[model samples]
Target: MNHWLTAPILIPLLGGILQVFMGYAPISLRRTLAIATTVLTLVSTIVLLVLASDDAYRLYAFGNWQPPFGIVLVLDRLAALMLVLTAVLALFCHLFAIGGTDEGNRQFHSLFLFQLLGLNIAFLTGDLFNLFVAFEVLLIASYGLLMHGGGRARTVPGLHYVVLNLVGSAVFLIAVGMIYSVTGTLNMADLAQKIPTVTGENLSIVKAGGMMLLVVFALKAALIPLCFWLPKAYARATAPVAALFAVMTKVGVYAILRVFMLIFGNDAGTLANLGMDWLFPLALITLTMGVIGALGADNLKTLVAWQVIISVGTLLAPIALGSTAGISAALFYLLSSTWTVGGLFLVADMVAQQRGSAKDKIVTAPRMRNRTFLSVLFLLGAVAAAGLPPLSGFFAKLLILQSAMAGPQMAWLWSVILIGGFFTLIAYSRAGSIVFWRTVDGHIEEPKPLGGNVSTAAGALIALSVVMVVLAGPISEYTDATAAQLQNPDGYLNILNTPMVGEDG
Candidate 1:
């Protein structure tokens, strides 16, 4: 059963390697292989999620080595949730790629599988070094996918994306080295156990390292000033790739929640809430910037990209509160935003394709092929993204608001969120009307048929948002339990540091 913890990662990793050898295979075969791989990964993740929900935690040791002595993987409620989400998103996005996007590049399927491999590993890893390794693996795979279609649009933003992430990687290494030098361990569980014992100069060094790690994670999460690279990079990337990349930002959020809370949280005494004072103000600014950018976006893709930033900011605002309720709200919001925003990207692409010369631009030269269908999707995606009622986003935001009321900065957080939602709704209204209703010259061109593939893929994603609303009670309860486990890290640490059965003898 413990070994099952590794299946989500191993399946895609092995699948990717097999995909590489099939370079000469037809595109359909490659698509089938990729889809099959993701489906298996999703099934494995669902099983793991179920197990984790019952068990609270599962730990796997490689090569029979124990704890900090060798590599290990952890599947807790949070990690399992993320893994299941990624697998689900990957499956649908892969289907969308098969609709036509994967044909542009021979390596898309292999790279996609490898991307899943990295994401699953990142979620499962119990060590900082392995987390960094996972980040690089996924990032390298993303670079290839971002430019799969090969255009100056992608190439230009791709370079900026590459450079920024490389720099983030460098900082990550520096931070990891600092932690290892001071605490003598890269295993997160060991670091948490050891972090409290450090004193004087070493404590300072650890604090510095922890702050640096936060910066690196913030960079990944695209916290304001560090976020300019995301819009163009995401907007230019193909729809399926961009949709999957939606989870990439949450990787940073997960790291911040997992590592920061477990390692430097209330239990750490003098080191508790080290940089939290700064996290809130910055997150609010990020929320404001994201809303402004979305409001002014000239194209639907760009608006959706800014929505990603908005989602990140919104989730973090609650997290910065550093309470169990805050974390629980953040987790729920995280799930909702990722799905809604991802769906928006897919819908925007589909609608853009049907608009001919206008593409996704706000100026509508013609009615979309499936105006009614696409309009409904766009409406659903828009309402969800805007945090309107009857969708997960509404409940997610409401939860955040409820959680934030206990915080000192409650007013500031509330104002920004409400105002941001207002602008978001306005932005969606503007884009929706132009893209779906109004025409540039007051004359609409004949609409074409939206292919079944695009509609299905995009519709599935939007439908998931609706599902989230329906399942809010169960999902929120799960997240609440997950956050409780996170706030009290004893179970996780006990599982990590306790020697395995045969090893103890």
Candidate 2:
């Protein structure tokens, strides 16, 4: 298992190939194959994670050249944490994909595996160009997944999805080229070292490169001005597709946190030298606008999409705070929100599908009287997203506010955070008020026949939600570790890009 270092990349690569081939097989066999391959990929990733967690942060040069001279896969606290999150989300999506899967869909397995592969690669790579390659892998897979079996449903937004991401890919390439031109290397740790030594004309070039790079990551993260593509595209997708859609934007957000912290934290980094003065107001407005959008949206699925945007903006507050505790809070919030927002979307889809669609209006059949599931789902979702106490999200926000409040002269932005939380409360309140209270003729009605294994997918989501409550302690510790690791960059750079005997000479 020397490839264990490369297993994260190779697992999905093989699984994706299997999926594409299986897509041409009989429907029953195809689905069974998809599930098995995905689950195997999950197992592969978990084994890798468990093995890596016990070891020092390390690197594997793909072609045997060391450090700055070779393309490498690096494992450290942050990358490992993202790998775990992606796997958890991917597992749930596959579970939900089972029954929600459309008939005659040509390449469900192929696209799903490829998407997962891209995410894992993005998480594992220690190089910037490789990061861009991974992003494109994800983009292309997502394009196919978002539109598959969507028919007329995906056409309009699918157009935006394709054209917009293609443009993003182009801009991303240009950014990579700019960085390589200036640094003469695309390895992340090497760039972190060279970025400080970089001088003269490249200073402005580096700044422009950083800004353009941020633009690319932000577009994917759905940060405010660049967030237009998110809701429309996600809202138009099928349920399982939407579930997977939640994981995709997060990769972009993760990139911003990873790249910015490593390169900028190295020396007078991007956010530090800039004091977040570069775009604090814009991020604040993004937070406000996302909350407002959630307030106005009527559809359950679309509302969930807006909430994802809200979480991304709330996440920006701490990056602006630029303190250890502030980033610790952001890490906590990121972990909880990713779980909550993604789980909520999948559950909403289940309810919507049972009730006929995701419309604001309730319309389940009189015989389909199982309001219990909806009640449980909405209660947890509202409590989770709104940051109610006794839940992980609440603890995260509390930690963030503590840091933001204590930071030097960030009170204005901190107040915006408090207001942002209130707006989120209101938005979640509006959704819950209608969803849990609206009278249907069969509010207490019995569960209607769901045709397949409803308990499998729904049960898994419910279990994950419940675990968020029970596992808060250990999860918080892990988040703290990741946050602290981001604050101190030497461990990551030292491990991955530091030259050994033959390489540096």
Candidate 3:
């Protein structure tokens, strides 16, 4: 039962290796192989998520090694949901890339699987060092993806993205070294047991290590001060690439939820406690700053990038409140953000193609008396992203608000969230009217020219939007269960100690 858990992590590694070696195949065939592999990985992840819906969290060890000594990979509700979501986004991005990419490149396809491999491992790993390695894998892959177009637009931001990630990697390494020095063991469960009991000098070291690690994660997660890289990076990348990158930053949020909430436990997260006090304040500021940035941005792609930042602000709610409701809200937000952002990028890609532009560098569309068909869908997606009611985003925001209203001192940030939401709505509406609405600006391209193939890749993206709406109910239920697991970390012991039988669960 437990061994099936490793399949999500292993499948991509093996597939990526095979793709990289078969370098001699035609570019089209190579892409077909990559999409096929991504689909297979997606199937495995969905199976794992469904199988674990009712099971206790479990971990599978390689070569039958015990924890506090050997490596461990965990499969709790949170990680399972993320794994399935990552696979789905990766598959869409792969398909979307086929048409949305004007460059017709195959290398992006090969490296993307490695990127998927890294992310799944990061979500699953039970040790600090292994997690850092997984991030490196993701970073290396992103650099290639970011620079795929081989022009000034991609090249300039590729440098910034790489440098920023390198800094993040450095901070992550320092934190890992500090944790290992203080605790003599790298396994998460072992650290969970040993950390709470430390006193005086050792306790100070633990707090410092936690803070440093959180700082590193904040940067990766695109929270507040460290989020400068997100807008420009995502804006320059292709639309599908940006959608996939949205999943990338959440990796940090996932780490915080799994490590700080579960492994570090209540003692580290309490308001009166100084251990992890920064999460709350940082989240509020991030939410506000991200919304302001989103509203102020003049272009659609940049606006969408800032929207991703806003989602990050929401993701921190659970960790900040240090309560069950907060955890639940955070899980719900993670699910909603992934869906909304994925849909926005997909529609944006089509909108970009229709306008005959990329990154909204220039909106070559003409204005009409009413909105275009694709423009209407684009606005709807953006509105959903901003948390309008009856949408997945609305339910997600409602859950977080509910959590904050019940918790201590959290009600204050409600104003900030609402203000951010307002600007977000205004921002998307403004962009909607400008690029997608009537071409009153005298810059509208020929109207009613939906004459392209519409591409199978682009269709895959539209499929994702449908998935978000259709899967919302079931996903929301699973999110509630995810929160429950984080609030109580007991099953984590079972995950790490449980023996495997048929497949990696």
Q: Give each model a TM-score.
A: 0.97, 0.91, 0.91
* Per-residue lDDT of candidate 1, residues 297-322 (tens digit): 99999999999999989989889988
Candidate 1 lDDT: 0.89
| Per-residue accuracy of model 2 over 1-505 as CA lDDT, tens digit each | 1366676677778877876766667777767776776677667677766665653566777667777776788887677777777777777777667664656576787788888888988988888888998988988988888887767868888898889888888888888898898889888888788888777888777777777888888888887688887887887787677877776777877887778878765474433333255445666778788888888876777778887888887787676556777777777787778777777776676566545432433322332234586667767776778878777778878887787654454676667767877888887777666665654564333333443444455546545645766877776776677677777777777755445545652
Tens digits of per-residue lDDT for model 3, 1-505 = 3778788877888888887787777767777787788888899888888877885666677766766567877776777788988998788777767653624565667678888999999988888889999999988988888887778988888898899889889988888888788889778877777777777787777777878888888888998899988898898888767888989889988887777765577644321233456777788888888988887887777888888888898778546777677777777777767866876776665666555333353343544422356666675577678888666677778777877754355665677777788888988877876775435344445532332333444344444444656777786677777777777766675555564454464
Looking at candidate 1, what is the lDDT of residue 474?
90
Worst 10 residues of 1 by lDDT: 440-449
lDDT of 3 at 263: 59
- Give residue 347's error in model 3 in angstroms: 2.1
Runs in model 3 deviating more than 4 A are 100-104, 267-275, 357-371, 406-408, 440-473, 494-505
lDDT of each prediction vs. the true structure? 0.89, 0.73, 0.74
Best by TM-score: 1
Compute the lDDT of residue 66 as modeled in candidate 1.
77
- Model 2 residue 363 lDDT score: 28
Q: Which residue pairs overlap in candidate 2's backbone?
A: 264-269, 369-445
